[model samples]
Target: MSVRAHIIHAVTTSVSVKLMRGQLAYLRSKGVDLTVLSSPGEELVAVATQEGVSYKEIAMQREISPIRDLISLCRLIVFFAQKKPLLTNVGTPKAGFLCGIAAWMTRVPNRIYTLRGLRLETSTGLKRAILLLTEKIACAVAHKVICVSPSLQARAVSEGLVPLQKTIVLAGGSSNGVDTSRFATANIEKHTDLLQRHNIPPDAQVIGFVGRLTKDKGIVELVEAYQALKNEFPHVYLLLVGNYENGDPIPDEVKTVIKRDTGIILSGFVRDVVPYYTIMDVFVIPSYREGFCNVAIEAAAAGKPVITTNATGAVDTVLDGVTGYIVPVKSSEETRKAIRTLLCNPELGKEMGQAGRRRALNEFASPVIWDALYQLYGELINRR
Candidate 1:
């Protein structure tokens, strides 16, 4: 019954605190001796303190560097050899690849790879080939691959990255499900001060987005769509609630527009994003791909209708036309039309938002995902 588990990610700030938020703590509560590993940072320390779990700082690079990667790989092997954990649930591309090999070499009984998203989906040529090979090796060494969404699972299987039997999507499809209580409809009226601070007018319709402001996140298309949308609804505001990643930089012009446009409110990397959802009239995640649009469901929980694309992980987030519209990726026209439809019909938007909240409560709540994950962990440990 003693279950020692280690969760590994490339960085602590983004993945550990954001994507995998509250997950480690929940697992710890369920009699798991959980330890988190990521590159050293203040956020890593904060996460350990907040989650009340032990952690080890393992220096790992996000980008592909042969020399650094080998050093990181050796460090991982040593960690696994010393800790001898019953299960090691590794995630993010770099950590997964290195940790998978280390776990396999150290003969960890239950090696679980949490496949969040495939970078290979967007890459081409030499980079794509490298990503594909590493991902395949990561999956090959793992006892189980937990895909965050059904579509991601399907894509991995279709690409021969992982067999269908080895990959599974937990509960509905989200790495860490949305916290319904924090983003409930009752709390919608509580963020008036926040809106006031941002100088967002009470009467102005707000279009919100909460993710990396990067090219792959469909930021270019979103900017284009918002520009077209402004022609119809001048009083509208685009509230971006995340930071731009240096790795996948958006065009210089797009960045300029985002910075200079008076109507666009940019709040870079807010630690607590729950209240910001309340300020939004409609939320959009025009992403090229996702593990599962966590922000989409969070918007739903906040009683806000969402407009997302039919990308790999994004396609599974909404009910389409009922909860939100699913527009084609890279199409500013379709995105504009969806935004226009919701803006023009206030009643329809409200109804859809209500429906989305219901869906989030029923399927994508944090406890639901945690329970499923706990059961899976027990099953995996028992099998070994």
Candidate 2:
């Protein structure tokens, strides 16, 4: 089949690029010529190369810097001019804003900005003001503004980031849906070797958190909750699976607190998070905020109950009590209560996990997501 269109996705880091590989592969199979461009790194380059997608490394920085940002803008404009992609999809507020501005400058036909989350939520003063302007411009210059969550879409509309008519949410709403088939608990038996390798007892009540161990993620509350519950549930093991990088880093205070808990295991950045999910009984993510916790879905798919904060993106995943419990943001007592409830009632946890798996399969298979995305792309490409 003739390659129907050329599409470009711009992201600031490899993490987004890596996470979207499956999505990209799906698009490629449908006859789209896909090119991914972003900052130079092992994370971005390796995936792009492995997937046989074209990639260009643009010099983009997260921090505010007028001079460096100017050079980065020039580089992006150059890339836009040369590639002239049919649709340019920009991710991350910084790169998205730059891509929008550069696409406008280069007059690319379709400029798309994926509004994952607002970085300004955690900032203050001049920095926050700058981020606000950046998000506004990203929405303004794009032909389409897409929010990954309904809450984000509503916020963007209320803030006038994008005209309400121009914004849309892909899928039922997630950057991409979790692969329930691969992440399912049926593979739990196969992961016994992983359990032995990690030295976790096969029968251990595995309590886990998977993401950057940062203050914003409420890692402090997680440490405190673990400390409070570990004594009561001695068989419970806390597994942390992520490596802090760039904008997200673990606070020293959080580190000091976790050091006091010996049952907690830190496995920095595993390639296959599925095995970890296979071994977990309960998943916890008390994030102060979240674009969306993909791990929560993965855990639910693996027939494991989840306990997460009532933050926008995350709260939607856990159906209160049906799938898992949603605790207050940054509240150790609430998180502890949720954990204790799950640990105390293994049958309830199993039932919730089963409910979660059914929900994911019914609502969020990858094909369902890709169809929505492709329809949106077709609409944008065909629109005047």
Error of 1 at 96 (Å): 0.3
Task: Give the per-residue lDDT of model 1 (tens digit) for 331-358.
Answer: 9899989988998998999899999999
In terms of TM-score, the best-performing candidate is 1
Off by over 4 Å in 2: 1-3, 184-186, 244-253
At residue 151, give the lDDT of candidate 2. Answer: 71
* Span of ten consecutive residues with least summed lDDT in model 2: 183-192
> Highest lDDT: which candidate?
1
RMSD in order of candidates = 2.0, 2.2
lDDT of 1 at 331: 92
For model 1, give the 10-residue run with minimal summed lDDT. Answer: 6-15
Estimate the TM-score of every prediction: 0.94, 0.93
